[model samples]
Target: MDRTRFFVRVAAVYALIGAFMGSHMAGGGGLELSAIHAHILVVGWLSMFAFAVYYKLFNIPKNSKLSVIHVWSSFIGVFGLTVGMWLYYTRPIEGMQTFNTIFFIVGGTILLIAFVVFAIMAFVHGKFISEE
Candidate 1:
């Protein structure tokens, strides 16, 4: 399948898993797990899936290597951020505080880069209509 569709599907799966885990954690009453679950559902699932749908609906060129790069980078970035949060919350480190901070910053930067690239590609595609 196309990259956009593929990513959307993957994001959906992540969302479902996040929901399940969140509910389970809530039922058992754990604050840390709940927070991690929220992060995964919101960032990893909802945001990523929304971006995928946006890219697909906008008809981003399949051959655009930049779009491909954006997709992969954003995916990895979000995945890392979510996973890192999960790790940090579940296994609180006593002195390795910098590790979690670095993970978040790196992931956020990667996602920001992906957004910039995606915007550039979309603008270059001339899909936007100007009422001059």
Candidate 2:
């Protein structure tokens, strides 16, 4: 899947979205989006970019199942978390507060699992670092 490329591309998209959100908040004279904006940039862009570099720097096998889990989980986790945050805060729909809350909490939990998987990946693949 060329995880390095995938992560970098997704990270770029997140960076753009975060920037746009930041600008919107600034120009609109409101900081309501501050938490979400920071998280989008940090988790989506920064963390994803770091993972891309991990793939680039390590000698991990391309066909490893761990990489597959890590990548997909990271992608899903980030998207879910960000969108869930948006929905939770905006509540753009009517009488959907329960759904929004559940979505937000689940998204965050998934993201945490992703992080744990990331740590495990490091341990399992750390041996490959020297091979790089």
Name the best candidate (by lDDT). 2
**TM-score against native, each model:** 0.78, 0.95
For 38-91, candidate 1 gives per-residue lDDT tens digits of 878877788778777776667667787887888888788777777677656655
Off by over 4 Å in 1: 92-97, 128-132
> Highest TM-score among the candidates is held by which one?
2
lDDT of 1: 0.75
TM-score (C-alpha, index-matched) for candidate 1:
0.78
lDDT for each residue of candidate 2 in 58-102, tens digit (9 for 90 to 100): 878888888888888899889889999989999899899999988
Q: RMSD (Cα, Å) of candidate 2?
A: 1.2
Candidate 2 deviant stretches above 4 angstroms: none
How accurate locally is residue 3 in candidate 2, as Cα lDDT from 0 to 100?
Answer: 91
lDDT score for candidate 2 against the true structure: 0.91
Candidate 2 Cα deviation (angstroms), residue 10: 0.4
